[model samples]
Target: MLRFLEVFAKGSQIHVPVGSPLIRKIPIFVDEHDVTAGAMKLIKVLRPAWDTSDVKTKLFTDGTTNKLVGCYVEDSPEDVVLVRVYGHKTELIVDRDNELKSFQVLHANGCAPRLYCTFLNGICYEFMQGDALGTQDVRDPSLRRLIAGEMARIHAIHAHNGCIPKPNLWIKMRRYFSLVATEFTDQASNVRIQQEVPSKAVLEQEMAWMKEHLSTLGSPVVLCHNDLLCKNIIHNEKDGHVRFIDYEYSSYNYQAFDIGNHFNEFAGMAELDYGLYPSREMQMDWLRVYLQAYKLFSQKGEEVSARELETLYVQVNKFALASHFFWGFWALIQAKYSTIDFDFLGYAVLRFNRYFETKPAAMALQIPQ
Candidate 1:
């Protein structure tokens, strides 16, 4: 084990033993709240040399599928370490490869954290030291403009042909709905409808709409950070620069998708329960900033007219509805098969209701060809 540990001296190997009592028993200093025993064990095996007496691990709160944990080795100055652990498997190996590639691309474009090293099973990057911009921070006009500018710059970078292929939106939507339907059928008795989950017939109609629209929508391929939630954006006070983290869902897609997705985050769709949805006026203001920045930074310099912007806005809502349905179904399934308690079906139904209520005006905004 010690011999194997030597190869990990730089903290770049992934196959190190994790969860073993022997691994846990290894004497190492760590911050109480920064990491789990499993994370620590992995860190110890691939120990990166630092002048600090001990290392601290701070688990970030923004993860769904994979555990996103940060390790900070405090020498005279603190340095950040980001570790993404996908469970042990061949799939994890592929994930690590993609993550490393994405990290490199983002770093080269000056959009993300500096890559330190990657283990075949996980990834580590130099920690980004800054305050994460919140809803309030994003509300500032200057800050919003800056963020918009950065996002445009990121999208301007050209991706290799099919390097990040776009997924067929309708196919993906059907898969999402199927997952939900399976869950609903299995737990029919437990499912409670808050706003009425869309009937299979209605869902099929929506899916058909997505398929038709997707085909008509021109492909404006660009490198996109598809998941640009506000939390993924970090602001460095020292340099007054904003950095993006998390590129797991990046791909080549329509520029409108990226534009609309970021706008959705600014719209505060995720925190609708908190009554944080932006006013129509506010939404327009954000759109203006985003479009201005996008035009300035995009290599194509394509001017997006107000009509086109509005149409894309409506399309984004459609995408959001699809996502809500998918998650709703996924949650329903998990609740059925696993020991988790949450009203996913109810939430999905609520989102569906909200979509219908807002869809008319949003659709009205679409540019008539």
Candidate 2:
């Protein structure tokens, strides 16, 4: 049996050993509170040959979930390495081991960035060049097609061992529900949860209703970046391609759920306006491109038909409700455990409120006979 020891190595004295008890040493160091210092330390180990003194860092403040810092030398700005510090107690919400495996799989398939290494509470990886897509940018006709094509390629990635893909939606939602707290240590937080959030029993009823209704949607199971918010999508104007990042929520899931979740994100996060949610006409256009690209990538030779587009249109709209419901539970759990300063309880309320408000219309969508 091997044990982990936290022996901090100083200067250039570093050791990477295999199966030797006496020489076992912690490979990387981490400081969650002081991410800049931690990022520099990580860069030293990641690029041992580079002059550590010449390294420059930029902290990306747009991310609400994790601390992201880009470290690079001045001469080679494009070769930046991103250091990601996991949010407080995020382990309760994310499966780190699974996330690593998913990253490797997507990287191998050319769908994601190269993962450098994993430390105590974070990861180092290659930084891609691009601007994160804005709300209006996604609505642009040409960019929308590019986004759809990229998503189709991602969904077409082969499953491990050629085994059938299984949906992670219900399983993850159930897990998140289990983690949602009934009370908080802080009086204000506890009071807020009690007054704003639904009761555990009510949430359970909604979950059951979703499973009963959505299970039979006929949506295929595919690898998905379950959380495909606007910021998660990076567009490179030089190459005219878009790449999805943040694998913390990536998994095999219902296809419509992935697309529908992305549509929900059209409302934006900082200040949500569901009025911005894509119209039925807009979704039809997006789904057409996605279907054609999915067929081409998956090697399905059939021509995409109107019926096919209609089918997915109905399925995606219905699954949009699941997206709202899934994230509602996730926010509740974050409210209880996350150290991030965001109003997680308020986010949860918004999600659940949207879920309730849209349920009537979303469930009303039906496939043509």
What TM-score goes with each of the models? 0.72, 0.90
Q: Candidate 2, residues 39-150: lDDT per residue as tens digits?
A: 8887777788779899999988777678889999988889999999998888877877668767777777788898888888888888988999878888989989999999
- TM-score of predicted structure 2: 0.90
Candidate 2 stretches with Cα past 4 Å from truth are 1-26, 184-189
Listed per model in order, the count of residue pairs whose N, CA or C atoms clash below 3 Å is: 3, 0
For all predictions, the C-alpha RMSD in Å is: 9.1, 7.4
Runs with alpha carbons beyond 4 Å of true place in candidate 1: 1-35, 45-47, 51-53, 87-100, 117-121, 162-168, 186-190, 193-196, 214-219, 267-271, 301-347
Output candidate 2 Cα RMSD. 7.4
